[model samples]
Target: MVYYAYFQGKAPDVTKKRFKTVWDIPKEELLAPGHRMCQGCGAAIVFRHLLKAVGKDVVIVQATGCVEVTTTVFPETAWRVPYIHVAFENAASVASGIAAAIKALKRKGVLPPDKKVKVVATAGDGGTFDIGMQALSGMLERGDDVMYVVYDNEAYMNTGIQRSSATPWGAWTTTTPVGKRWRGEWRWKKDIVGIALAHRVPYIATANPAYPLDLIEKFRRAFETEGPSLVHVLSPCPPGWRIPPDKTIEVAKLATLTGMWVNLEIVEGQPRVTVKVPKRKPVKVYLKMQGRFRHLRDEDIAFIQKVVDAEVERINKWVGEEAIGPVVEE
Candidate 1:
């Protein structure tokens, strides 16, 4: 079933522009420097911008993954805000508890009645799409007032680049290696956004680091909305994807330009494409840059392009406009 139309209603007023210029953004740096993340780690950028958008009155519950290990090494921490490191499969569960605690404290006069603190749960694709699915489902079903952000790098990059359900079709990883009898990952990427939509969350978005303004605006919306919210970010890994550190932003922008990734948000049961692609670049332009798809044959690339085209067409039809256009050969 097409999940984009699942939430059919009047669209909210999203015409107002926020962050017109870089100077309009707050200068406060919530995420300090001097961490151990790689030079071009896209997840690090996601965290930095997220904190800036949400500000200092937030509690971050992060799963044990690349960001957790790299940022919070025993004696030092890069986060300037309240942060808790939880097990891989329970970040959502912990965040739910924290939200519940804040409510209880406020009711009993233990905390100020007007005190507002945002509870955010963060995890990688391995933790979100695979191990933490059950916990996240429970949090959504229970109607917890927490925002869950998944910085998907496509695989378990912290554990040697193993394949996860979020990994794209025909992408090579340690487990899904290209060989004589087998190609890369045979299955399509899991639809975490659709799954979250099924739970009837108040807010859901897909973000990329290449578009900082859009990403920050989505975070602002998620924080303002009540009930459970989910933001799935496409975080490119330099080491795992076998790309140079400097090409992280370039590859991320290519994903959206090629219709491989769509920036969108669902607010109050209304879905809209945030960034429109009038003329999509061929999917090959995106696939050729990453070493993970280096071994894919011509036919394999054609097959992948066919899948992307169908998906983009479906989205365009649902939105009643050509938000993403047909692929054009370059």
Candidate 2:
């Protein structure tokens, strides 16, 4: 039997070079020229593509994470669009407020009657998976018309290179500092999508920077919807992950290929989303590519691979050809 969740009523069209350049987006640069991100920050790349998809007619409520500090300076900022720097744990609530305010502002003619805008809360995995999970869950339950994009680099990147709930098992971080006694972080990556599924939101999807156009479409569709939307984007962080700058996208691709992360999307109330099966490589191949996991031994790799296989099997169960063609949950 095939399992189908969100992405309902239609299939996600992945075709054409919709974004030729960064300027192709009419929203303008909401997250600007920059103050202090690393040479190959996957979050930055994801941000650029996201802005291109959603456009600048939006208000960004950023958490006190890497994206927030790196782009926004107190007096002067890089944001060309209206943006807010909320606390570490309240970006979702803040963005929800902004959405409500926009509605009221338009109703009272405070801004404009025909104000076409969206509230997007962008944060790292540290914010989304760990500290900010409560706020994120609250916003989803509230079902605010907003987009919560988690640029998950698997660590608390901004403050320092620390492990996060989203960090996969067997990865290294400051908190999970690897040594002879320690074999890296020993916990599994929390099932963020499963958590979102628990909320039963209208739309939730896992994305990758390797497939820019697919990610863009998810954002665009999420924008058009009426409730909360979650896009779990696996963006690569070079400095923290100890990978080269240009290798961000490639590393991101390998993540899925190793069955560590699979690409899928869930629409309103669906049982599962469209899943793209990977080539299924050894997790060690991915681990070895990054310096963070350099200390990992063959036994460690085997153990990690077992976890990854389980994850892939779970996702595969959610993806199959059902009697109902591409069914939507709602």
Candidate 3:
């Protein structure tokens, strides 16, 4: 009987969570208790940890997506920190503006300049990989002092499981469900990290809620950076991904084990990848665990593997590291 899985009562064991000590982290609350989110919602997890990293002197700009709606209902607000909800595609630019304004205010000594403020934008994969992409690219190219985090559950979860450019190839979404005659989602996930790297931001990293401490550390680092930074987070949408609520972190860990999400980073002072992905588990295990890929046949599975292989190979070449993910053998 662990005291980890309930709002106030008993429930099944959730994905294994590590306990924190008082000396390790503060008891500050940012997301607050009244916000509405699903059980095992990865976005909420990321949001909480992200706030913990940046602390209270931060302005959070969010898009009109799940996070924004859940936190800011018309008559109520759940955010303990200053927050602004922008249009679906404007979160990045709005964060950039907020950062610029904060910097100007601090320089003019309008507000207490000693209290360093961080500007963070939280957006889903759809807003990031689709609509907000251009604005994000522009922000990074201009080297704005903002941190943008994408809580990627791999689809448009806020809009009822529609496929997004971040959705994995074999995963099933409402629009890309595998029928009897069809294979699965036709296109591959857009390589947003590669695109971000091409822009050459000061820092770019991939994080997972399964690894909360790691995610928090990256956020702290990104928050302290002066130029534009991105932390691509892999969140688990249990209902959207057809996994059980208890398996949110499990699913996230499986993503890393399957090479579906690589935990790597480009540091501010370096041009090479400072982190490396470990030997990964089979993709089939990760795929079959989700009902979305229930209809994938063996050959179709092989095709997905090929796509992942090519993508990993390209990343390895870019990083000058030897290939570490799965490859098709003769």
Top candidate when judged by TM-score against the true structure: 1
RMSD of 2: 6.0
C-alpha positional error of residue 186 in candidate 3 after TM-score superposition, expressed in Å = 0.8
Candidate 3's displacement at residue 63, Å, is 0.7
State every prediction's TM-score relative to the real structure: 0.95, 0.86, 0.87
**lDDT of residue 231 for candidate 1:** 91
lDDT of 1 by residue, 82-163 (tens): 9999799999999999999999999999989999897999999999999999999999877788889999999999999999
Best by lDDT: 1
- Writing each residue's lDDT as its tens digit, candidate 2 over 99-164 gives 888878989989889778889987888888888999999888777877889889898877788888
Task: List runs of model 2 lying over 4 Å from the truth.
Answer: 1-30, 271-275, 321-330
Where in model 3 is the C-alpha error above 4 Å? Answer: 1-23, 269-278, 322-330
lDDT by candidate, in order shown: 0.89, 0.76, 0.78
Q: What C-alpha root-mean-square deviation, in Å, does candidate 1 show against the real structure? A: 3.0
RMSD of 3: 9.8
Instruction: List model 3 lDDT by residue over 52-131, tens digit each.
Output: 88889889999877788788997888888999987999898999899789888888989787867878988999999999
lDDT of 2 at 130: 86
RMSD, one per candidate, in order: 3.0, 6.0, 9.8
